[model samples]
Target chain A: MELLKERIRAEGSVLPGNILKVGSFLNQQMDIALYNEMGKEFARRFSGTKISRIVTIEASGIGLACITAQYFNVPVVFAKKHRSANVSGDLLSATITSYTHQTEYTVILPKAYVRPGDSVLVIDDFLANGCALEGLVSMIVSGGATVAGAGIAIEKGFQGGGDRLRARGVRVESLAIVEALEGPEGIVFRK
Target chain B: MELLKERIRAEGSVLPGNILKVGSFLNQQMDIALYNEMGKEFARRFSGTKISRIVTIEASGIGLACITAQYFNVPVVFAKKHRSANVSGDLLSATITSYTHQTEYTVILPKAYVRPGDSVLVIDDFLANGCALEGLVSMIVSGGATVAGAGIAIEKGFQGGGDRLRARGVRVESLAIVEALEGPEGIVFRK
Candidate 1:
């Protein structure tokens, strides 16, 4: 987490609307070295959880989940935002609104991937409104899988999504929690 | 590649329109163990090239690219299919037509990631129309970067995407090339 925070302070840009753009390393362009560290941290944080699978929603989450999955030695199941002709079998689909794009889309996964009593860990790059996380959680529940926990790179704590999931008894661990942010003032994390 | 072919033959469902659904392992639900093997193979295939970065399209390609990047000891840069408040700086955007979705969408990547003289290897889950690869190649070329080669998990030989790219002098190593596939007759590969 210290390394991630340092990387964020070094390369992250603060934009209007309290947005933290990490495209240089985290989202658009990924730093695999950093990703591997994050993965090890997640593994340490969620050790002995017996994660059967890692769930995420595309497109940013795929990279993180895949890399982190190596530490867990598990598979990754991502919910697709769009329909694919190749996808068959019973599926668990949930609709979620993208706070970034400001549009509603469905996230889908095959039922065969996550079965009853599977322990699933959700991972993503960022968690703001938590709509994407919500959709993934719903899909996991539909498949009768238990959410081992959720690992996020950055969390906008002011948005209250992380807290809400914790209140529901879901284990949510975020590397850096930004309690607040402002133009030129940079970021403030919850103590 | 034999492992990939066996998995596909066992789990991949043959749908209408020559679609091979390997979502249970390749895209939607990813097998990290298998992915790591694929990564090792990609590393072996491109061992001679000096790959500075791994470039891939959004959504599904992110996972394979990131996992494969570890073997190459380089960073992974995935193009974004959707816009966001987080995406800033000048971008290189390419419009791609998705035959599966039957629509056109633009993929964007920050200009800073792929700079002049950078050697990028494009990786993706599948190769059908070659449009996605073309988009990434275009962005890399626009940034004055050199494309060392391409790695694809599965290439539909009938669709001609892989052949077309190879015709352009791009070194493409497809783990499994489906020379022909038919219902009941099963898939035949080009050895």
Candidate 2:
């Protein structure tokens, strides 16, 4: 976690409107070593939580979830942002709005993957506005699965997504939580 | 490879229009253990190539690429399918026509991560018409990087993608090449 926070401060760029750009490592181009570390941290945090499945939304979350799945010994089921030809099964779908994209999209998962009473760990790269996490939670609820908590790589703590989930009693763990950022001053994390 | 083949035969659905669905393992719902095996196999196949980076596209390929990157000890650089506020860097973009979705989408990678003359290992979940691979190849070429060939999970040999790449003298190694799939009667491989 300290490593992630430090890397974020060293490389993360702060744009207007609270957008933290981590494309250098946490995103567009990934650091597999860091991902493994994050995976181990997640495994360490949620040790013996009985995670039967790891669920994530498409694109960014897939990398972390797949890497972390090794520690959990579970299959990773990612919710598709777009309908694909291969996605044909009873699906658990939910609509979520993205503040950055300024659009709403539906995320879906195959029903066969997450069954009743399955303990699930929801993982993602960034959390803002809590819309994406809410969508994953909805799908998990729809599947009659238990939410075994969530794990994230970097979180925009100012956005209040993490707090909202915590308020709802969801155990959300973020490796690096950015409380504030200014030009050259860099990112500040919650103590 | 045998484990993957067995999984495909047992859980993969032979959908209409020659679509073989292995979503339960390879893509939508991912088996981490199987992916580790597949990734190891890819490393074995491309053992001699000095792969400096592993490049792949988003959504499905991210999972496979990240897992495969472990074997290469290189970072995974995944192309983004959707544009967002987070992605503001100079990008290498290419259009890819999806064989399954029957639609075309643009994939983008940041210019900062993939360096010039870097040896890139292109990894993806499935290879049909190879449009995605071609798109990735274009991006890598635009970046002045050399593709150390490709390591594909499954190649639909009945389709022309892998053959075309091979005919062009590209180094392509697919773990399981399916020549034909006549329902559960089983998959035929090209000798």
Candidate 3:
């Protein structure tokens, strides 16, 4: 987590409306080596838990989830933002409002991917308001699967979404948690 | 390649309009082990070529690109389908038409990611009409980067995309090329 925090401190910039831009290394342009470290950390954090599958949303989360899935030796099921012609069959759905895009879209997963008795670990790049994470958890639960936990690369602790999930008893393990995004003064990490 | 072909023959379903759904293991639900093999195969195919970076489109291409980057030991830069508040600075852009979705979208990448000396290898999950690949190639070239070539998981040879790219003198390495998709007889791979 220190490495991620260090990278964030070095390259991350605070944008208006509480947005932390780490696109240089995290999402848009990915560092696979960093992803591997974070993936290993997730595996270590959730070592004892049984993870049958790893779930994440499209675009950003897919890379991190796929990398993390290697440690668990499990398959990754990404929730599609919209239903496509290729994705056919009964699907478990949840409506999610994007924190970044500010648009409400339905996220869905094929029912056959997550079945009863499956332990699913959700992964994503960022957890600001946790709408996307909650949507994924909802779909996994609807498929009769167990929510092993959620692993996030960075969490905006100031937004309180990670804490909210914790209150709901979801084990949300975020590698780097930003306590405050004080402008000019720099980011404050949760120690 | 044999493993990929077997997975396709066993699980890939040919849809109504030439859509081959391999979501079971390729895109929606990803098999990390299989991806690792494909990554190794890509490394083998593109061996001896100097690859400085791996480029891919967002969503489906991210996973394969990330996995493939491991073998190349380079960072993966995925083109964003749309501009977001998080992505800042000058960008190189290209217009791409999705063969599956039948929608045209502009893909953009930060100019910083691809420099004049960078040798980029484009990676994608599926190559149908080669529009997406061509778009990515255009962006890389516009950035003054060299196109090291492309590594695709599955190329619909019948659609003429991969061949078209190859005809353009681009070194395209497809793990499995589907020469034909017979209705009842089943899918056929090019030798």
Candidate 4:
């Protein structure tokens, strides 16, 4: 987590609308080494949590979930943001609004993937408004699966999404949490 | 490769329109163990190749690229299918038509990621018409980067994508190549 926080501070940029851009290493251009470290950290934190599978929403979360899954020795099921022709059969879906894109999209997973009573760890790259995590959790619950917890690479702590999930008794772990960031005022980390 | 072939024969289904569904292990519900093996196989095949970075398209290709990047000891840079707020700066973009979705989408990558004269190995989940790979190759070329080769998890040989690339002197290594697949006729693999 310290490594992630440091890399974030060194490379992360503050943009308008309170946006913290870590795309240089976190999302668009990924650091596989850092991802492995984050995976090990998540595995250590979630050790003995009985995680049967790792679930995440597509695009950004897939890489983190896939890398972390190796440590958990579990499969990763990413809910597709778009319905493709290749996707068929009954699906468990939840609609979530993206604050970044300013649009609402439905994320879906096949019903057969998450079975009843299965323990699942939801993973994502960024936890901002918690809409994506909520969507994934809803799908897991809809399939009668148990939400083991959530793992995040980075969390906008000031956004209050992580706190809301924590208040709901969901175990949320973020490698790097940005406490505040607005224009040239610079970025702050949640100590 | 044998393990992958066995997984496909066992779990993969042939649907209408010659679609082979291996989402249980390859894409949707990903098997990390299998992916590790794939990473090893790709590493073995592309050994000694000068690969500075692994490039892939987002959503499905991110997992494969991330896992494979460990073997290459390089970072993974995925092209974004959609323009998001997180994406900034000038981008090298290419339009690609999806054979599955019957839609066209532009893939974009930041200009800073792929440096001039950098050797990049393209990785993907599936190679059908090779539109995604072509788009990725184009972006890499546009960035002044060199395409070391391509590592495909599965290729539809009957579609002529792999052959077309190979004919152009590109080193394409596919874990499994499906020669043919028709409804009720079963799938065939190229030896």
Interface RMSD values for all candidates:
1.1, 1.0, 0.8, 0.7
lDDT of 1 by residue, B1-191 (tens): 89999998898777777877888889888899899999999999888889999999988888999999999999899888866777877899899988677779998988989999999999999998888888889899998999999999999988898899899998889999998778356898878
Q: Which docking category, incorrect, acceptable, medium or high, applies to candidate 1?
A: high
TM-score of each: 0.97, 0.97, 0.98, 0.98
Model 4 alpha-carbon miss at residue A136, Å: 0.7
The docking quality of candidate 4, as DockQ, is 0.88
Error of 2 at B160 (Å): 0.5
Model 4 reaches what TM-score against the true structure?
0.98
Better candidate by TM-score, 1 or 3: 3
Per-residue lDDT over B107-176 for candidate 2, one digit per residue giving the tens place of the 0 to 100 score: 8888877889799999988899989998888899899999899988889998999989888777888888
Off by over 4 Å in 2: A183-185, B182-186
Report the C-alpha displacement of residue A22, candidate 3, in angstroms. 0.5
Candidate 1 chain B — worst ten consecutive residues by lDDT sum? B179-188
Show model 3 residue runs off by greater than 4 Å. Answer: none
Model with the higher lDDT, candidate 1 or 3: 3
- CA lDDT of A149 in candidate 2? 95
DockQ of each: 0.82, 0.85, 0.88, 0.88
In candidate 1 the C-alpha lDDT for residue A156 amounts to: 91
Task: Provide the fnat value for model 4, as a fraction from 0 to 1.
Answer: 0.88
Which of the numbered candidates is closest to the native, going by highest lDDT? 3
